[model samples]
Target: MADATKNPIADLSESEQLELSKFIESEQQKVKLQQAIHQFTSTCWPKCIGNIGNKLDKSEEQCLQNCVERFLDCNFHIIKSLESTRK
Candidate 1:
């Protein structure tokens, strides 16, 4: 991927360049995380809640909460398991 940090504005001041690079990297990471969350939400919402007509009902909301919680739990467990297996 092209480094956006190489532009003239970023190359102007040393501190500004570093700060801009960090900001760009952080924003890219944020976008990636947002995309992942959106994908998970899209898949999980349908699995947890059947059909959607209007605003999310209480039951559907509960299901979404459960989906998020379970997804995090699964991610945590997977990371822990990987660490152990790497030993």
Candidate 2:
């Protein structure tokens, strides 16, 4: 039987490892962004939409825009507060 605990990434050179790490981190950020967008849409959809319309009326469009803005503002405020606490 062969040992199964080895990591293949450990075989790469230092530069290669760093590059792979950065690439992985970039991909993770993209995934997180996508999840946040989905969550934003999910939360705001039912709140602003009452029926399946051909297109969004002006009020519905405004509501969605406001919802997204508020969501972003809340997240930014929380992040800033956390950073201040860490300092």
Candidate 3:
């Protein structure tokens, strides 16, 4: 019997292996996306939200939208800035 702790991939058929690889890749992508969302919310919540209400007011909602846009813009700006210096 194969050890329970051993790599299960070794016992899988080629098709099963391919499916497992694709599943793992998708799961990893989901985890990365979830992490990014958590980071974005954490960073934006304080800057955009105020006075813990039952729901977000329109102003707060707009603030969060703008914050995320600005954050993405900042990331792109930094990437461009670095590329310019590398030349």
TM-scores, each model vs. reference: 0.72, 0.82, 0.78
Q: Output the number of the TM-score-best candidate.
A: 2
lDDT of 1: 0.84
* lDDT tens per residue, model 2, 1-87: 756998888889999999999999999999999999998999898899888789999999999999999999999999999999999
**TM-score ranking of the models:** 2, 3, 1
True-structure lDDT of candidate 2? 0.93
Kindly indicate the candidate among 1 and 3 with the higher lDDT: 3
lDDT tens digits, residues 26-79, model 1?
A: 999999899979977886877777776778888888888888888888988999
Better of 1 and 2 by TM-score: 2
**Whole-model lDDT values for every prediction:** 0.84, 0.93, 0.92
The alpha-carbon lDDT assigned to residue 6 of candidate 3 equals 91
RMSD of each: 4.8, 1.7, 2.7
